[model samples]
Target: MPVIEIENLRKTYSMDGGLSVEALCGVSLCFESGEFAAIMGASGSGKSTLLNILGCLDPPTAGRYLLNDDNVAALEGERLAALRNENIGFVFQSFNLLSRTSALENTELPLMYNHSGLGMTEIRRRALAALDRVGLAERADHHPNQLSGGQQQRVALARALVNEPSVLLADEPTGNLDSRTTLDIMALLQQLNDQGMLIVMVTHEQEIGAYTRRILEMRDGLIIRDSPVENRRHARAEASGESTTRLNATES
Candidate 1:
């Protein structure tokens, strides 16, 4: 069975005139284990809506969502929160780190809520390991303000993975970074995907989408196309005598 499933999921936002704006119009999808996926769409194209539902941060208006075969649409309140905390990790474009906390402390925050019996020492150990995975272990003691934007983002990503959730949901992860930092983060995500982590990312940029195995494109609250990367695309770029620049690992 797929690790995640959605059946006819729909969400509508009601306006003042009793008119409704449908954000997701009964979209259905399933995610396989360890697959790297890119969710791409124009603005107002339901990418955020779909992501929000999948992350368990928002409920669908009408449809069935089965995550790990459990009826997610039927879950509510603390049940939904517990399920989300246990099964999903999120990396946002804004790098929403606590302003006053160190990187290690920020990464350790989630474990404090995981109900684990491990003490603070174990939590720090695990958080450091997660930071190492994202190549941010050296910045463990740095607060968000003390780090560069890219470094802060890496710290936020470390916090997301510290719990080892089943799915990693990233919304515009590279949107705020320069091109170089974007590739570094993309490479890190690729490495994680290769190591059997399921990743679902939302992006409007084709460069970032190229790193994923599959792309789901949306428009006007509907999925327009679901496809694999076209070989011709790479061929065309190469034909134009273009070269891709690599991100400097040490920058972040």
Candidate 2:
């Protein structure tokens, strides 16, 4: 079964003044494990709307969304929330870190929120490990303001991975950083993909999207182009000496 599925997903919003806007008309796609895909579009192209639905942050007005073969669009209440927490990791363009908390605290927030059975010691350990994955272990004691834009983003990425989700969804992750920092974050994401993490990113920059195995261009709430880079797995494998980099994702 496909890890993620979206079929004819539709979303429409009605404003207070009775203005109805159709964000997504009818879109369909499927994502498999260990795939790194980029979704790109211009403003008002419904990229964010589609991403929200895929991440379970919002519901579509009409659609068939299956996360691990379960109809996520049909789930409600705690079931929906639990599925989201268990299967998805989210990263935003802005490094959404708390102001006064240490990086370790921020990374542990997910496990602390849903998995209260874990002792603080274990949470701290896993949090630090996630920090190490992003090469931010030394900065685990630092707060958001103390780190560079790239470092802060890495902290956020660590927080997302601390839960060990099936898919990592990033929305405009490089929007706030400089060119150098953007490249650094992209490299980190490349490394994560190499580690067999399924990643779906929304970006406006073509250069950043080039790093992914697949590029999905969305326009008017539909996927217009879905193209894969030739030899993407080979490119990834040569980047690191890790068995995870050898894993390949299968699409339906």
Candidate 3:
């Protein structure tokens, strides 16, 4: 079964003067387990709107979204929040770390929302493990201001992974990083995908999109192009100054 499945997903915003602007006009998509996919588009192309719905941050105006076969539209209030916390992990462009908190504390934020009744020791252990996965275990006690941009982003990634979510959602996660750091983060994302964690990312940069196995381009609230990357760029190779090449062609 697909990890995520959406059928005719639609979202519209009611603006001033009884005007309604459609953000997503019947987008249908399916993401399988272990897939590394990128959503690409220009500004106002609805990519962000789709990501919001997928992250459970917003509800679609119409249609169905199934996460692990649970009807997302059917969940409400605390149940929806719980579902999102349990299954969806989010990383954003801004890093979104609490500057006053330590890396380990930032990572434990997600678990704090969890209703599983976990003890503090267990939460700390999971947070530390998550930081280790993102190569930031040694910086567990460092505050956000003490870390570099890339390191801060890694902290955000660690926070996302601390929940052991079924899927990782990243919105322009590398936007604030330099080119070198961009590749570094992409390499980490690739490694996570290789380890069987499903990842869906939003990026407008063509070069950045090439690092993913699949790219879906949206325009005017619709996915105009959904194709497997013909020449996937391996971030590890790029980071190591080695040329890499791979080819495949498939369409969604």
TM-score of each: 0.90, 0.89, 0.95
Q: What is candidate 1's lDDT per residue for 47-164, written digit by digit as tens?
A: 9999999999999999999888889999977888877777898999998999989999999988888855669889999999999998999989998999988888899889889998
State the TM-score for model 3. 0.95
Clashing pairs in 1: none
How are the candidates ranked when ordered by TM-score, highest leading?
Answer: 3, 1, 2
| Candidate 3 Cα outliers beyond 4 Å, as residue runs | 242-252
Q: Which is superior by lDDT, 1 or 3?
A: 3
Residue-pair clash count for candidate 2: 0
lDDT over C-alpha atoms for residue 20 of model 2 = 87
Candidate 3 residue-wise lDDT, 144-201, digit = tens? 9999999999999999998899999999999999988998999999999999999999
- Best-to-worst order by lDDT is 3, 2, 1
Q: Which ten residues in a row are the worst by lDDT in model 3?
A: 243-252
Q: What C-alpha lDDT does candidate 1 achieve relative to the native structure?
A: 0.87
Tens-digit lDDT track of model 2 for 167-204: 99999999998866776788789889888899999999
State the TM-score for model 2: 0.89
